[model samples]
Target: MFELLGIPPQVLFGQLLLGLINGAFYATLSLGLALIFGLLNIINFTHGAQYMMGAFVAYLLLNLLGIGYWPSLFLAPILVGLVGIVLEKTMLSRLYKLDHLYGLLLTFGLALLIEGAFRQMYGVSGLPYPIPDVLKGGQNLGFMFLPNYRAWVVVASLLICFATWFLIERTKLGSYLRAATENPALVQAFGINVPRMITLTYGFGVALAGFAGVLAAPIYSVNPLMGSNLIVVVFAVVVIGGMGSILGAILTGFGLGLVEGLTKVFYPEASNTVIFIIMAIVLVLKPAGLFGRAR
Candidate 1:
């Protein structure tokens, strides 16, 4: 087998693939965070809870209604997005004029409420979600065994991330969203329903989290506590990526995941802390993040 830097190609590629899979989740979650922060100026602490809710919702659909993975992929996000819209209209709207910290506190409370309710019902044990029949196998790519579903996830996430980036950064509706984020009053004066837009944007961001949960359901055991573990690292990803740039969030997410994977290969002890360490270094070197603009 070919070798690079004293490592076999197989090992290197395999780790890289795993890194990309992890990156897909990080990118999706961070993209949602970036969108919410950009529009609402609030860190959505309930995001992880929403993600957990998505997996649970899928499980419910399967058990009660006989819905499968493919359907849940669409339905879970819609249901979760609706929940987000309700939260925004009923609770989050009231916090708009207050300090951003108020929004954070409100969402943090909401996260606890959500997680607590689920824990009460489901407990902390993980539930298995069967992979769809079609995507349940792996392919030999000569150098490594690549799982079909994993490859699909990486491609789908990249497409979704770039599509979101293009929509927000290139389209007219995106222009309105950006404008509303900058100055809602002015956007409202221009005949835009700024409040409604904010609500939908929040829903959309939450929906992205839901979509990720669906993708993750088959890969990891579904548990009330799964999102809790992942969200902290994702938050660090957001901080390192910077809040102002959507692309920055996507890039940082994938980059950090790969770095973490590499660390696992070379220095197993540092895998968990590598991302945070990188965040500290980034803060010291460029407080605005790699792709972030100094504000």
Candidate 2:
């Protein structure tokens, strides 16, 4: 079928697979962005830093404590989330009453500081994280050879995305969060600990970025700058999907990833700018974003 378009099946499917993998990361990262924006009303510029921290923590665990990717996979996010908890309690919490731009500026400064510290320590070179033995091989599927690790990344991302959506969009806890976002004073009047919930929500959002970081460590070089470029794309995804729309963020993340991948196959030069182009069109056509509800 692909041959009809002068493209090989391998080339076509390969790009698609790659796109899905990129989408997975985009989905996870953007979900966190939406969550923070929705519940906390803060734009966490530190998210990319937290993600870089996740990869660094994984690297540290493996080198210093003799832990591997599997254990670090779970531990990295938890550790980063804890750091987020501290930041929320000490810094982010105070900014809640201020303008949202203050939060963005503060977090952006934090991001730069964290990235600079890591760069000072590790230098600009990317440290390598080997793929685990369990996911070392690839299977040939006639059309293409599917990598075990890449498959795991996509599957894990999907599961994580769905699980987060279910938890936030369906559960009782989610109900409280929505209510609190709507009116914290009213929710507090009803006996919910809205303040604490806000803190946790920020941590949880940061943890998602950390989660993406851990997943990305093996695929890309684990470096301080790893999250820099990616976060811009995720920000674009948030805009395209409608900022603060959780499900919209997830769907748009994966959808754009596929679009990006296909662009690479069809028009290599345009691949880099395709997402931005979509963003421009979306801004003009639907400034509220594709899934965003107007206030």
Candidate 3:
């Protein structure tokens, strides 16, 4: 097999696969974050906790109620999304008129409360989420073995990302959403229910996180701390990709994941900080991010 820069093709491809998988999660989570930020102007720090909640919800459904993976995949996001709606109605809505920092502080507090509660109840250990039987095996791709579940994750995430982008960018509903985001008063004057839109947008963003959680559950241990760690890297990803662009977030996420994966194969030590380093470079070179527009 051919080698590049002292790395074999197999190893490179394997890391690339891993990177793509990570990028899927990054893309999904960041897109959710970007949507919330773009529309609500709120930095949702609790996004990771909501993702953790999605995994826990799936676990609960399976272990407690005997629900299978397929059902939980759909149900988990809906449940978590409803919770988001409730939070927006009860707590988040109050801060809409306040300084943006208040929104951040409130969400940060919510994240801590959530993570702390789950840790107290479940401890730090992770629980296993079995992959569906149909996706149990791998395919030999000449130089490497590709797990069915991982492949599914990449494909499914891409589909969802593009679908979301289309809905927000191309559709009439998306036009209303953009209009509301830009001028809620004027949109309301035009007969749109701005508050309902905000609530649903938050719910939808939370749902995206839930979807990611279900996908991640089979790959990583379903732990309370899972979202906490992943959120930081995702934040870096959002920063690098730019907050204003949905497609940018999607592209940056997958591209960074590939870069990170290759780094792991060639220099494992740098893999951890590679994202932050990239964020820093992007900041120095383009303060608004690779695809972000200046505010």
lDDT values for all models? 0.91, 0.91, 0.95
Model 3, 54: alpha-carbon shift in Å?
1.0
How would you order the candidates by lDDT, starting with the best?
A: 3, 1, 2
Q: In candidate 2, what are the lDDT values of residues 1-295, reduced to their tens digit?
A: 4483898989988999999999999999989988888878888888888989999999999999999999998999999999999999999889888888999999999999999999999998999999999999999998898999999999999999999989988999998988887888999999999889988998899999999999999999999999887889888888899865678888999999999999999999999899999999999999999999875
Clash count for candidate 3 is: 0
State every prediction's TM-score relative to the real structure. 0.97, 0.98, 0.98
For lDDT, the strongest prediction is 3
Candidate 3 Cα deviation (angstroms), residue 206: 0.4
Task: For candidate 3, write residues 1-295 as lDDT tens digits.
Answer: 6778888888889999999999999999999999999889988999999999999999989999999899999999999999999999999999999899999999999999999999999999999999999999999999888999999999999999999999999999999998887889999999989999999999999999999999899999999999999999999999999998889999999999999998899889999999999999999999999999887
Which one is best on TM-score?
3
Off by more than 4 A, model 2: 1-4
Question: Which residue segments of model 1 deviate by more than 4 Å?
Answer: none
Candidate 3's C-alpha runs over 4 A off are none
**Model 3 TM-score, 2 decimals:** 0.98
